[model samples]
Target: MTDRIRRLGMTAARFALSGALLWLLLSQTDASALMARAAAIDPRWLAAAFALTVVQVVLISWRWAVIMAGLDASIGTMRALRINLAAFFLGQALPTSIAGDAWRVLKIRSLGFGIGTGVRGVLIDRTTAMIGLVLVVLVTAPLLLARMPDPAMRWSVAAGLGLGAALLALALSADRLSGRWASGRLSGVAEFGRAVRGLLSRPVTAIPIVGVSVMVHLLAGATMWLIAGSLGLPVGLVDCLVLMPPIVLVAGMPLSIAGWGLREGAVVAVFALVGVPMDGALLMSVLLGLLLLLVSLPGGLVLAFPEPGPGQAAPRRIR
Candidate 1:
């Protein structure tokens, strides 16, 4: 009972913080202007953005299936899609960024998969996707720097790219280091390491997953581009490619509810570097968030009517 109360308290705190930040941002902007901009969005651009979002989800689901296969837990693509969408919906709708991932882990475990396998699959999938986002940011770092007139912002972006690169290297090396340690306290770490190594050892499986991750991010950038276009913001695809990754990385942080205030703030700051109007950028970001929420609504149906159990349709053996 105490634990339950503590959990509830933490949840309430998170919601309060998210609400505070969102209110703060909205208060600073012209609410009337923001709504007018939103009202003026071109339906065709929004349609394209929506279409790209669907493609992004499907591709990401396939990537998850690939990772599961690599880990010797073979889930079908269709099932993976359902689970992914459900998780996505939960993640967005819930107060925490990890709500959907936690749901995915539990759902997979319920399918008769081991807890370790379920946890490892989700962790590795997220790790690889983060690496991909970092790579996107790094690859376009020079372009981003060139666009920034302020030395401080340029240096900040460069430092972030360096940190991202260093973290990626560390993640890649962690698996190898885990093999040398045998402490029981580190057993979980060892298990994750082995899983990482197992996935990377098979490039045939690993490369495609990473490749798809890059594509997913690129598609995400495209979606943002369309959103910007809808808002009549003078932003280009390259700008979105450079800006979206960092905004995404920041928003993925566990601070705000579904990245509401954090994403808007980041978008406003990043777009300012390129001379885009803050109000328009904030509006575009809000639209993108709403579109994602709309796209994830199908997951509610999956949650209501879950797929059959493993006994009904046995999981395929990992090849």
Candidate 2:
């Protein structure tokens, strides 16, 4: 009951934060202009962006399957797709982004895999995707840095880089650190770390996994470009490539519901650097969110009418 209360409190806090941020942003922007931008959206471009959003989820789900393969667990791409879609919906509906990840882990666990393997697969998948985003930001660092001459903005970028580097280091060295706990009560931790080391040790395996993640981010950028185009925003693909990663990185934070307020704020702030109006950027971000939700609607259906394979019973509890 205590844990449930704590979870409820956290959810309430996130809802409050999301509401406050949105209120602040919406108050500053011209409501009429925002509605005008929304009204002027090009259906053709919107459709294209929605299609790309579907592709992005498929690629991510495929990456999940590949990650499972590395862990010596094989849930074919189709199965991964089902799980990814359902989790995607859950991620959007739940309080935090981690909820989606938890759903993925739970689904995998339900497939009869040990809890340890399921956790490791999801962790590595998430870590590699983070590395991919970091690589994207670093690759375009020069352009991004040149555009932002403000010291504060520079420090924001620097802090982002520092955090990315730290995560990369921790992921690479987790196995070594797990050794100390090998004989301890935390056997699961040791096993997870060793699994990470083994999976990433092979160049052949590691390269493709990371590559897929990069592709996922790149595809997402393209989708964003299309979203901007739909709203007739001045932001270009190159601008999206250079700016969207940080926006994405920020939006990925679990601070708000489905990245609602954080994503809108990040979109407004980052695109403003490229001369996009705040209202336009906010509209584009909201449209992007709605379209993404629409694309994942199928997942809600999948979750509603789940099918289990013969001899495999779906676990009642997600732990």
Candidate 3:
């Protein structure tokens, strides 16, 4: 009971912080202008953005499937898609972003897989995706440095790439050392480590997962480009490619609900560096958030009628 109360308190605190930050951002901007811009956005561009979002979902789900295959738990592409969408929706709608991942862990466990296997798969998938994000930023650092003349922005880009490289190196080294420690004093730790290493050892498997992650981000960037176009913002695809990765990485942090305030703030700051208007950037980010919410609505249906797994009985009540 005490633990449950603590969890509730923490959840409430996070929601409050998310609401506060969102309100603060909106208060500082011209709400009327943002609304007008949104109102004027081209429907066709929104349609394009939605299509790109669908593609992003499919690619990401495929990546998840690949990760599961690495674990020898190979699920079908369609099933992966369903689970991904449902998890995404829950992640956004729940009090915390990790709620979706928890749902995923539960789903996997329900399928008679060990909790460790489920966790390992999720961790590897997340790690590969992060590595892909960093790679995107590193790969585009040169173009960004040349195009954007802001010294501060250049330094920021340099720092981000350096951090990304360090993280990748650390992950690789940890995977290598995990096997050595598996039979050591910390058997549990070593076991988890071995699991991570096992999933990541094969380049033939890991490379494609990373590639899919990169493709998903690219599609996401393109979706942003379409949103910018809808808002009549002067941002280009190259600008989106250069800026979106870091913005996304930051926004994905568990700091705010569904990345509401953090995403808007990041988009506004990055677009400013490239000379795009603040209002337009904020609007574009908001639109992207809305489209995501729309796409995730189907997840509600999935939740309502969750399919029973093997050796399990159907729920008598959904509410």
Measured against the true structure, the TM-scores of the candidates, in listed sequence, are: 0.91, 0.92, 0.89
Compute the lDDT for candidate 3.
Answer: 0.81
Query: Per-residue lDDT for 1-319 in model 1, tens only?
Result: 9999987887887788778877887888887888888788898999999999999999999989999988788887898999999999998988867889888898888888997788899998998898778777778888878988989988987887888788667655654564544456665665666677678678898788879989988999999999999888888898898888888888888877888888888898888888877679888888999999999999999998887786787446698
Q: Superposing all C-alpha atoms, what RMSD in Å does each candidate have to the true structure?
A: 4.4, 4.1, 3.4
Q: What are the per-residue Cα lDDT tens digits for candidate 3 across 1-319? A: 9999998888887778778877877878887888888789999999999999988888888888888887888877887888888999998898788888888778888888888778877877787788788778778878767766878877877887797788666655553564544456645555555655666678877777878888888888899999999888888898888878878987898877898888888888877877877778888888999999999998889898888799778768768
- Residue-by-residue lDDT tens digits, candidate 2, 133-163: 8888888888888778698989888886988
Colliding pairs, model 1: none
- When sorted by TM-score, best at the front, the candidate numbers are 2, 1, 3
Alpha-carbon lDDT, every model: 0.84, 0.84, 0.81
Worst 10 residues of 3 by lDDT: 174-183
TM-score: model 1 vs. ground truth:
0.91
Estimate candidate 2's alpha-carbon lDDT, on a 0 to 1 scale: 0.84
